[model samples]
Target chain A: MNNKVALVAWREYVVRVRRRTFIVATLLTPIGIGLLALMAGYFSTKGAVSSKDILFVDESTIFRSADPTSETHVFRFSDKNISEERDNYLENHDVLVHIPPFENLGDKKHQVQYFSEEKLSVMTINKLERAIAKAFKNHKIKSSDIDMEMYNSFDTKVVFEDGEVLEKIAAGEEDASKSGKLNLIIGTILGATMGFLMYMVIFIYGGMVMRSVMEEKINRIVEVMISSVKPFQLMLGKILGVGAVGITQLAIWLILIPVILWIVQSTVGLNDASQAEQMAEIAQNMNGQTSLEGFDIGQIISEFQSLNWGLIIPLFVLFFFGGYFIYSSMFAAIGSAIGDDMGEGQQLMIPIVIPVVIAFVMLQGVLSNPNGSMAIFGSLFPLFSPIIMPARLAFDPPMWQIALSVVILILSCIFFVWFSGKIYRVGILLYGKKVSFKELGKWLFYKA
Target chain B: MSVLQISDVVKQYGDHRAVDGMSFNVPKGSIFGLLGPNGAGKTSLIRIITRITGADSGDILLDGTPIQKTRVRDIGYMPEERGLYKKMKVGEQLMYLAQLKELSASEAKKVINHWMDKFDISDWWNKKIEELSKGMQQKIQFIATVMHEPSLIILDEPFTGLDPINTNLIKEEIFRMNDEGTSIIFSTHRMEQVEEICKDIVLINQGKKMLEGKVSEVKQKFKENIYELIYLEGELKNDSTYTIVQNDGQKASLKIKDGLRANTVLQSLIQQGIQIRKFEEQLPSLNDIFISLIENKTV
Candidate 1:
């Protein structure tokens, strides 16, 4: 790079990095996110442990008896009527559930009333409804003279096995099926996280570049700068400098967020050992009630270890730079064209913002089917590839597709930088005139 | 030898010809004035010379070599709209500009320190530009312009927002730098400063040169053979030898008749029994010449 360009870049970096806002935002954001995650975890565990106790007043003698104990709700049968229990239920039980006798077993509109001192939580209401329905079904089955063992055996679940997993199983790999499911879960999460992260960083740092350019122009320092070095050089330098700031912030977050979360988790673990034990017992009890039967943390860790991070990490960085360079150059152009009116600047931003938003919205489809035609097309196109490709990286998409996307993105980056430089050179000196897209097009043809 | 030369320069913006076939040269170590009206292509021509923008068709030679990217280090420019990063410290801003002008970091520091001390603004090194008053900022701007010590310096309306004290301070600095063999191009519509400082001038109007010469020669060229007379005794009146343009008791302004020398008019005035206190030929001021030239173009 030219020495003058380096000088400009260094100045930009130093000025921004020294700002109090930068320092505060860089160090505090991860800490804030960590605290929020911890609060969410604590609340969920607390909710699971606090089970509601209910008095079940069954006026229908035909109803079969149930176990009456569940992970989140405990039921106590009562021979007394609902009205008799409702007035005094608050003294002992959290709720009084009244199931009245009905003539029709096939009726779907039967109502069950729950009387409580406070509004019942949605989770508690759902559990009560499920228990009543199960008892009703059991009573109908018994009246029909059906064997209960044969009826219970009719409930079945279907599990999907990928071809690769089947092949591994046939080859006598013990944990192939578990690893396949784990890969799907982890890949979806990693892909979504990486995709959204790229989207956010591009906007944040790209806007920074634009604002920096506009500042120079508004300050009227642009003329002084261009007189010393080429306008193209100045623009390139600003983009690089602001990008470095973004990367530095990202790197800090990458290191700080996990560390902060771990510290908070360990401290909470040490401080609330008895609460932790209660949480483990609740989890164990809930495991039999909920459908999440095969959830194993150890298996998840192994699956994550088996990922192609060597390819994914490096490609992520490449796409990051490629995306940043392409978008920031366009941002620099728009910044230069804007005089003092910020509204006009926003008008120019629509064209650039539309593609980014489309890429983000398309991330869902890509994560759902990483090898779908829409995914292939989105990931191959340079404008959307930076966001979409990183999302599909975990799926182990064909090597040719990834390579082609990378090549296209790199070429597009070069073209955009050159194209924007043309506009930037002319626009930075323009003032007090309302610039339109038509005017910008004309500027592209202007002599340097 | 000329330090800078522009030949047949033409710059057009769409239908408007900002600079049309304009040419001039700045002699070595000379304080050259580039005088023009608001839209007379003075800035366009200056930009070409400084390599901020290229001419459509022209040659800009620095020390007889065609100007190139590398030659940017040989010239320093302060535009009509003075600007520096308001958030940047005075010392750091100057250092940045100096390095852009190709000064090494150490050389830039040394030169910046020397200038700060000379301007008695060493205390302002750490002060942000926004913290200073406008005049103080202008002072710092001037220091930034010349701190790199370019061979040629171009200042466009360099004194616009300055108070008289700071203006004189900058004016003195311009002269001192010229004395040290740095050529200067001073572009402005203000002509009195040109008269006071510039040795040579090029007056342009409508993207074309209207006048060019030494300040004294141009003033002499525009003189109309008029004279101002202050006499102690007689009341002056219009006559065949001269026409009285303005008259008062014991004072008159006369336009001498064609084919008559200035001495003949003085002889005629002395023969009228008037005791003369003062008599001198009147030469037009640059302000008058500038106004006349620009107004003539409009007519």
Candidate 2:
């Protein structure tokens, strides 16, 4: 590196890092994430939703068996007559449901009166209705003159003409268990988070490079700067400097996040447990599952383990550097061409940002079907690849595809740096008139 | 000996020539004034010399060697569009600029301290450029330019926005640097300043050299052979040897006729019994010569 370029980069890094805005924004972010994690942990440990206590006043003396129910509510049977015991039940229970004696046992629509000191939550009411309906179904089944064992056995078999019966135990969803579905959700969430982080870094840091260029132009330091260093050197120094600041901030977050989370966990008496375990517990309770059945802790763990970080991490670094350099160079060129007018720079940013925005919009599609044609195109296209390719890595995109994306992104970054350098050489000295896209095209062909 | 030389330099912007066939020599240890009106291409020529821009067809030599990138360190350039980062501290900005000129860190820091102390701006080391007044900023900029101890310094309108006291301070520094064998190119329209400081000058008009010579020689060359006379007594007649351009009783302004000397007019006036109180040759000022030459397109 040229000494002057190093000097310029150092100046840029030191000046920006010392700013109150930069320090505040960088330091506050990890703290904020830590706080958010703490809140999430506290809420999860308290249980996904607070369980509501329900008193059942069954006048018909039905539902003597233990209830199979959702986790969000506790049900109890009251022996005393509700009419005579209404005051006692009301004194202790906030919600009381009174089931009246049935006149016609065949009537499926039985009436029940719900009384409460305060209005029960809609979720609580829904859970109570489901429990009541289940109880009624069980009562109707028991009153029938059918062999319950035989009926269930018949329901479990699918009879064929050859007397070849298929047991329901080996049903269509034997492999497609609830846990399998949970794994898919976990994979998509992980992919989206990575994609989101890449998008933010590229977008935010890219804009920062452009603003820095505009600041130099407006302050009229560009001429003095270029006098000492070549225009390309100046732009490169700025990009690298701002990029270093970004990397520093990211590195801090990477280190600080786990430390902060550990502190938060210790504070909440949840130390010594892994994040995945807490997440599984939180996920299970969120669905109101009384037992961990149908909530796959193992499936989620395997899914997370299956993520190809070895391939993904290196690719992520490559893509981030490539994407940031390309976008930031263009931003710097636009800033130079527009001189001191920030408004013009903003309008010109739309065309440059369109592809990145498109990639973001297609992020969901890419995450779901990593090998789909759309995903392939997004991953390979230089403009979108930096964001889409890493996201698809968790799904193990073909090696050739990753290699192709990396090569294309690298070549494009080089092309953009060369192209923007030309415009920058001429633009930094151009002070007044607004430059149009047409003029910018002409600037590309300008002699060095 | 000439420390810098430009020959047949041509710069064109479309069909209009910004610097056309411009040539001049700046000798070592001399204060060379580059004088011109607005848009007279003085800035363009300076930019070319400073290597901020290139001339289409010309060669520039420093110390008999063709100018190259490394030679940029030997030249100090303070452009007319003077600026510094408003948010950067004065000392920091100066150090950065000095380093940009290829000074090592230790050398840059030491020179920065020395210049800051000499300029009496050591208090402003931590103060931002924005916090300083325009004159103070100019002083800081001047310090930054010379801190590298370049062999040649090109300053374009460096005195603009400076109060008289600060201007004098800078002027003294310029002379001192020249005395230390630094060739200084002082570019400005301030003729009085050039008269006060410049030993030699090149006057350019319309992208071409209109005049170039020692200041005394150029002044003497433009003298109109006119004499201002104040006689205490007697009457003087306007003869073929001399013509009185203006006569105000006791004082007369006479233009000596072609091939005649002022001494002849004085001798004739004494023979006519007129006592001469004062008799001195009058020459046009640099400003007047500049205007007439540029306006008339005469060499």
Candidate 3:
């Protein structure tokens, strides 16, 4: 933070922040995400509310007393023959379901024909099949004289139980199981979002730093600046400056996205009755049920509130900066080594790009098993920790592992910055030379 | 007193020595020429003086103290491959560079205004560097170099893209700055400007000093004892005292023999009844000396 370095940093930050492209990108991102959410909400709501009315030609005689209505379909038993209904059902009903008569009730190969003018949606088809199968089971159960109460009791579900939740339940905590389920969902969502976000910022802002360095070199302004200040100072100033830009954009997005989403939800979620119904249906689906009794927006909000924001938020900031610094310094080195030919730098970029790509590719696996061996190793390894460790943060991994990862990441950031400064010192003054990895290695050892 | 001094500097790049055991001095308030062919280590030595790159083994002193980071304020270097941020405004770019030299914001603004006014480029204050013509850009760059008013200024090939008028304008400014007691190191291969403005020079080749002295003294050291004569009568011919290097009907050039006086040659010409209209000794131009020295054809 010397005076000259600070001056250079201020220049770098101001120049980029004032660019038209930066302004457009910063403003458009939240709008784009808002639009995407609107589209998804619109489509899901439309699909869920488009109810189908069915004419059931029950030739098998088993579904004659079946339930008349389900979540998305209304069924009516018809007395007409199959040919009569098939030709006239389109005038009133949306579909004609003709169940074939069979002597054996348990035969798996019995065919049922469905006739519709338009292609039926996958959800509609699956629901119809399930309704017909349920009718057959009921008929067969009545004929065999099975006890209805005992049969109802046989529908058992397997619930996932973690050791901590089991201990809480033993300690007389009745809502422990409910909170555990919510934690699983929230952890997966938070980890994936955070991991992906870290991956993206490293590439986006790191590339910004690289291109800015290359621009200075190409413009040949670096030599004049170098004469006034050390190369290390210049490089550090640029990284910090562009890093500030990244943080600024992130802060804006954090505020703008929620506001925009709230506006969209109020407009699209409140005015449309069908969208409210669709959200209730999705909540029921998440609870693995077909009834809307479990749909509670307040409970979902409480679940979100239950997260350990005090730990997660600060760790996220630390990892975000650590990852950005580590990758950007190397990017600055590659940019300096590129010379006048822009294409020549691609080969040197492979080493830096590989780790980030690997971290992103491994994100899914880490989310599935946050405390597994792969997740543990990936989270502690300095190169991958910025991405993987933040992803595991929501899972509440062991405190010792988190501490170790943070320490390693901070140290690596310092090392890489110093290392890249060495390469940048020699490379900025070099022109028209195709620099290679070997050349960069030699420059790393060069005297300042 | 010398404003800057270098002693036995050696800078090696792998197997090749870019600056090999070089030494020189820039006297206070003098315009000095650093003359060398391309790749002759003139830039290497300049970078060392500017402290852009450290010399592998050497001692560089500014005002009798070893050069350090703080000394950057005392030296303004406009490198040969120099440029300004094209997208940056002329005034802001000047302010940024001024601040790097530790100028306060208020001081920088006042100095920038004075320079822009002095150069009559006040209208270009808000214009980006890329918007200016090449000569105009060069003028702005020259102003940036001197706006800090450093005790020493190093300009490498400062006049490459300037038009004749701008070049003269810059030349006048250089003379003015020197008269105000700034030590200037002018580096270029253009020998004519060196002959016109430089009081002393160091000519180097292959990273080694080949010749160093006052401009007139070096030209005298390379003189060939040749004389040009114009006359109205009599003919000239080779004799025991002098040889006719070239001859026309009215003018002749002669080279005196070793250890022979110009008076003796003149007497011989008089005895031949040559009525001399003009007679003057010829000294070599710097360009000729530079070529002969680089080509190693003459001492």
Give me the candidate number with maximum TM-score. Answer: 3
User: Candidate 1, A25: how far from true, in Å?
Assistant: 2.3
Q: Give the best candidate by DockQ.
A: 3
Number of clashes found in candidate 3:
0
Which pairs of residues have clashing backbones in candidate 2?
none
Candidate 2, A1-448: lDDT as tens digits: 3776777788889998899998898788888988898777665444444555668888766654535454445677788888766777766666778988866778968778888777765545655677777777667667776666766676654322211112322454322222334445555666788788878987888888888888888887776667667789899999999998899889988998888878877777753343444455545658732223444556656656655568778778888898899889988888788777777767778877897889899998888787899999998888888788878876657889988988899999999999999888878877787888877887776544
Off by over 4 Å in 3: A47-81, A91-94, A99-111, A131-158, A165-179, A269-297, B297-299
Q: Clash number for every model?
A: 0, 0, 0
DockQ of each: 0.64, 0.49, 0.74
TM-score-based ranking, best first? Answer: 3, 1, 2
TM-scores of all predicted structures: 0.89, 0.85, 0.90
> What tens-digit string does per-residue lDDT give for candidate 1 at A32-102?
98888677567654543456787878777544365546654576888887778878988899878888886
i-RMSD per candidate, Å = 1.2, 1.8, 0.9
| lDDT tens digits, residue span A1-448, model 3 | 3988889889988988888998999989999999988886767655444677888898888877765466556778899999998889989999899997857856766679999988887657766787778888887888779987888999996656687768776888735424555676678878889999999999999999999889889888888888888899999999989999998899999999999989999877733555566665566657742233343667667767767789999999999999999999999999999967878788999999999999999999888888999999999988899999999987879999999999999999999999999999899988888887888888876666
Cα lDDT computed for each candidate against the true fold:
0.84, 0.80, 0.86
Total residue pair clashes for candidate 1:
0
DockQ-based class of model 2 = medium
